[model samples]
Structure formats: structure tokens, C-alpha cells
Target: MTIAYDWLALGAAACWAVTGLISAPQSRHLGAFAFTRWRMGLVFLALAPVAWLSGGLQQLSLVQLGILVLSGLVGIFIGDTALFASMNRLGPRRTGVLFATHAFFSAVLGFLFLDERMGAQALVGGVLIVAGVMTAIAWGARKDESHAFESLQGHWPTGVALGLLAALCQAGGSFIAKPVMAAGVDPMAAMVVRVGVTCLAHLLLLWSGVGLARAQGTMTPRVLGLVLLSGAIGMGLGMSLILLALRHGEVGMVGILSSVSPVLVLPLLWLTMGRAPARGAWWGAAMTVGGTVLVLLRSHS
Candidate 1:
């Protein structure tokens, strides 16, 4: 991968990490679903003007529009919703650990659906990444060794399931977006279409699942501002960076870097929480991160 793409991928990860902090307060008050729904809407509202100004709005064909819109729905709407549910259940740190599994998930999905080929290094890296995840979250059995079985006992099945859904959603979105972005539409129009679909999907979700929360009241200005900030960070900024990285380098490289989110999350958590994981979880996190790094290195050369 080129240095520019490396920076872009890393930058995307940082913005996404910061977004977790931004969205936390809003999720606390508005609830995750309610917060995500509004965040999705406001993001498009904020992105639309910029997209228009960039003249990204004027360059769309019907087919590109459809694919782009679908990309948004799959990625932000479904992915974000499932992710929040998983995060709530698993906590950001552990959920992040699961999310680090994204490289593997994408690989699997592509293998099954797209017939993508994985060379030896890529395959090894995939194994290491999964092992790293297992390590990062692993606990112990009677021998007090890191036990996969113990890690499996954590309150994260639903989180893992939802995370898997989010991973697939994001992968699907990225897959669809390739042609759209490559088709050379207005970048802003692309943004608008992407977030617009997210907005609509969130609306449907709110109507169906967040009725009680929605009826509580619209968000306060501060809440809305923060949610919008997160949406900008996540969708506007984070995803944008990913697209840029793809333009500059290999998707496999970017995907591997993305799996490093768990490692990034740990320091963020350590700073935020003022504590480290217990020995087992700590070791698990280390191994998981190391494994991910191994995977990245395997492909990088």
C-alpha cells in the first residue's frame, strides 16, 4: 500500500474512535437506536449542502444513484443499528474487539459471494487476526491459561452476532460503492446519496422500533449537535477516508488496517476508563492486536 492510503486508513480509524466518545452521551440519553436514527438523518442534512457545493450533486446516473443509496442503507442504517445493539451488549472495548474481526468477515463474505482469492499471506493474516481477537477477549479455564471457552462466556453473543451483521452490511456497502465511486459521480452527490439512504432506513427503524423513545421528545440542541458531530465523524469523515484509501491502495491492506481498531480502542478506553483490563483480558487484547498486526504485515510486503 502507498503511504498516502496508509495515512488515510489510519485517519479513518482515528475519526471513528473519536466518534465513539461523541456518540456516548447522546446514546445515554436518547438511547442507541434513537440516537443512531437521528444521527443518520442529520448527517445527510449536513452533508447535502457540501455535496451540492462540490457539484457532486449534478453527476449521477440512475444506476449509480441506486447502488449508492443501497450502499448507505446497508452500511449506515443496518450496520450502525446492529453495531449499537452489539456495543450496548458487549461494551465498546469488547465490541471493538469483535469489530476487529471485520477483516475476516469481509474475507469470508467475499470468498463465499465474490469468489475472491486469498493467497498464503492473506490467509495466515486472517488466522492471526481471529486468534488476536480470541486472545484480546479471552479469559481462563481451570489452568488459568487463556481459554477460548472462557472468552466465549462473556455477554457478547448478541454483540458478536450484531457485529457480524454490521460487518457484512459494511462490506456489502463497500462492494456496491466501488462501482458508484468508480463511475465518477460527484463525490458530494455520492455522500448525499449514501447518507440519504441511511437517513431513510433509520426513519423506518425509528417508526418501527423507537416509537416510545421518539415520542419522548425531539433531541435537545446540544444532543442533536453532538449526534450530528458523530455522524459527520463516522459517515462523513470516516467512510470518506476509507473511500480515499481505496482509491490509493489495495482493499486488502485497508481492510487489514481496519481490523486494528481493537488495538486503537484499547488505549482510548484505557484513557477514558482510567483502568486496564484484568490480566486475562489484557493478555487477550495484546495477543489479539499482535495477531492483527501479523496479518497486516503478512499482506503488506
Candidate 2:
């Protein structure tokens, strides 16, 4: 069962990698706030009916519902908006590396708040995984690489700050949700609440006439399609998997497994951009795989 949860986390990582790839251009086009708003709206539309039919919403107590709402606001609303904002400035690869710090944040928070402790082997594996992700992204791009995805868009410091904030909020959100999930809240129902609250928040922000909340580029059919696709896969499916993993898995372990998104994104970038990653990327990927094996083996044992 632990191994199964590990796989679920890995699956979520894969989904998020794809989402990051699909989101880069659209995020730049729509602006981070607008893109997040639109994506959350779409995710809410898609998940609401399913959650209703499943009748999972009724299982939550008022306190649990409140906690879930807060998780949504922090995780989906703020964390996601910050993530894409960072991506717009730093590009997906660098942003991903910074975002990978969430694993450590989650581990620490789990220890402090949830009293979750990892074995020595698992801790070492987590360290290696994070090191590999940072290595792969920090040195991933070639010197002469001129692809838009490799180019920095705005102030690098601002991008870095946003990335770290996103990571922290992500960890915080998971910490908040862990208890509710462990109490046997349906994953889909929990997701609907989180996403629905986030969608409402975004709508409120947009309605407030904030210029930053407005779309930066004209919305086209192609962009809308990409938004819907990324939202469905990343927020809808990916997040649901995370919730499921949290149902039985420790937050630290789930976070460590899911933080492999940066490593996973490498191959997808290679496929989409038609260029092989650097030697450092391969080495880092190898380390990431070894670390993942260690973690999984620890779980099995």
C-alpha cells in the first residue's frame, strides 16, 4: 500500500511536468494571475459534477470543510499563481528546480506539525533526490541554447522569490490537507472544495478590477485549448492523485516523490524542443533515479 501511494505520487509528478510544459507559453500570454483564474475555473467546472455524484462533499464536517478551503486558497490560489508567475520570468526549467524545494519544506513541516519522522535511509534518499533535481535544472541548459523556454523573461530575483514562495505554500497546503485526507475524505470531493474555493477567490480578484489580474494577451482558441488541457491534467488529475497519496502516505514521503517533476520535465523538454539535454542533466537524472529507487525500496522493506 505504501508503494502504491509512492507510485501515485510519481504519477502526479508526471502529470505536473506535462502541465508545466503546456503552461509555459500560455502563462506568458495570459499572465500568471489570469491563467490561474481561467485554469481554476475550468477545473471547477470539470470536477464539481463528479464530486456531487460521488456524494463525498457531505462527508466533511464544517471544520474539515474550512480547512480544505484554506488549503485551496493557499495551495491552489496563491501557490499556483506564484508558480506560473515565476515560470513566466524564469522559464519552466529553472522555476521547476526552485519549486522542488517543496519536498524539504514538506518534510520539515510534517515533522514539526504532523510529528511525521522518516527513516535514515528515506531521509538520505530525499536529500539526493532534491540535490539531483537542483543539479539537473541549475545546469540543464546549454550555453548557446536560445530557445524561448531557456530564456529568462524578467527580473531573476523576483522569479526566484516567487518560486520559493510557491514551494512553501505547496508544503503548507499539503500539511493542512493531510489530516482531512487521513480521516478518509474522498479525494475527488476534497479536490472539488479546494478548487471551487480557489476559483471563487480568483473570480473575486478579477471582479475587483485589479490591472494585474487582467489577461496580458488576447485569448485565442489555441490558448484556451491549452489552458483547459493543462488544467484538466495538472490541477484536476494531478492534484487528485496527490490527495489520494496523502490519504495513506506521510506528507514527507508523498512530497519527496512528487518533487521529481523537474527531473521528469527534462525528457519532455527534450522531446518538445528537439534538443538533447546537457551531460549534467543526464548525470542528475541518474542520481534522481537512484534516489527514487532508494526511497521506494525503503518503503517496500
Candidate 3:
């Protein structure tokens, strides 16, 4: 089950990577907060049947309901908002490198808060995965002329601060969900609760005039399709897979695998961008995959 869940986490990572690749341009046009709100709304609609088939809201206790809602707020709402803001400040490359810290945050917080511990080998594996991802992203990172990097000159500190906060929120949200998932909550059902709450929170923000009100204007057919695909793959499936992983695997290990999206993005880049990855990128991706395998093997043994 641990091995299976580890693979599932990896799959989730791949799905998220694809989501990032496909939806980035659309997200830029729509604004991150607006895009996310629309994407989650789509995800809510998509997951409804699955949630129903899985016995959905009926499966959760009052405590579980609260935890899942909190998890959604912290993870989807706060963390994602911070992440998009960080990307706006820092380029995607810097933000991507910073995002690698999430696994470390997960490991540390899991230890302190959940009493979850990784053995030395697992620790080494986790470190290697993070290092590899950072290397891969940073090595190939080019300046995006589109984002007006010069304008962000003095704002780097703000980006760094927001990036760290995003990482913390991500890790913290997972840790908060860990106990509930371990208590036998179905991952699919839990996802429904989490996404449902997140959708409502985003709606509340919209109602309060905090979120942008240009959903109809910004969503072209192409953009809407991309967003729907992203929501289906990333928010709908990827999130549920992570939850399933949390139920069956160690938090640190699952976090490590799930955060390997940058590594997974390499091949996609090659295929789409018409350039093979640099040797450093290849080496980094190899190291990340090797580390994931090592972690899974150690768990199995």
C-alpha cells in the first residue's frame, strides 16, 4: 500500500506539472486569484459525482469536517494565493526553486506536530529529491521578458517572504489533514470536503469584492478549456491522490514525491519547447527519480 501510494503521489506530481504547463498562460491572462477561483469552481462541479459515489459528506464526522475545511482554507486558499503572488514578484524559476522547500517544511512540521519521523535513509532521500528539483529548475531558469523583471527589482524580499509563507501553508495544510486521513476518511470524500470548502471561501472572497469580478470577460473558450483541464487533472485528481498517499505513506516521503513536479516538467519542456534539457537538468531529474525510488524501497523494506 505504501508503494502504491508513493506511485500515486508521483502521478499526482505529473498531473500538477502538466497543469502548470498548460494553464500558465491562461492563468496569467485571468489573474491568479481569479483563475484559481474559477478553476476550483470547475473542480467542485467535476468532483460532485465522485464524492457522491464515495458516500461523500455522510462519511465525515464533525471533527473531520472542520479539519478538512481548515485544510482547504490553508492549502488551496492561502497557500495558492501566496504562491501566485510570489510568482508575480519573483519569476517562475525563483518561485519554483522556493517551492522545493515545501517538502522540508512538511518533514519538519510532521515531526514536531504529528510525531512522524523519517529514518536516516529516508531523510537522505528526501534531501536528494529537494536538491534535485531545485537544481533542475534553477539551472534552466531564464528570465521571462513578459513579466517585467526590472519592475520587481526591490520587491524580491517581499517575494521571498511570500514564497516561504506559501511553503509553510502547504506543509501545514497537509499536516492538518494527516490525522483525519489516517483516521480512515476516504481520500475522495475528504477531497470533496476540502475542495467544497475552498470553493465556498473563494466565492466569499468574490462576494466581498476581494477577488476580481472579470470571470466572464477573461475566460475565452481556449482559456476556459485549459482551466477546466487543469482543474480536472490538478485540483480534482492530483489532490485526491495526495490525500490517498497521506493515508498510506509517510508524510515526508509523500511530500517529497509529490513535490517532484519540476523534475517531471523537464520532459514536457523538451517536447513542447523543442529543446532537449541541459545535462544538468537531466542529471537533476535523474537524481530526483532515483531518490524517489530509494525512499519507496526503504519504505517497502
Candidate No. with top lDDT: 2
Model 3, residue 151: C-alpha shift (Å): 12
Candidate with the larger TM-score of 2 and 3: 2
TM-score of 2: 0.98
**Residue pairs of candidate 3 with colliding backbone atoms:** none
Candidate 2 structure quality by residue, lDDT tens digits, 162-190: 99999999999999999999999999999
Stretches off by above 4 angstroms in model 2 are 299-301
| Model 1 lDDT on a 0 to 1 scale | 0.65
List CA RMSD, all candidates: 5.0, 1.0, 2.9
lDDT of 2: 0.93
Number of the predicted model whose TM-score against the real structure is largest: 2
Clashing pairs in 1: 56-186, 56-189, 132-288, 135-284, 136-284, 136-285
Question: Candidates sorted by TM-score, descending order?
Answer: 2, 3, 1
Weakest 10 consecutive residues, lDDT, candidate 3?
142-151
Alpha-carbon deviation at 101 in model 2, angstroms: 0.2
Q: Write one digit per residue (lDDT tens) for candidate 3, span 236-284.
A: 8888888988887777777888889878877876776666666778778
**How do the candidates rank by lDDT, highest first?**
2, 3, 1
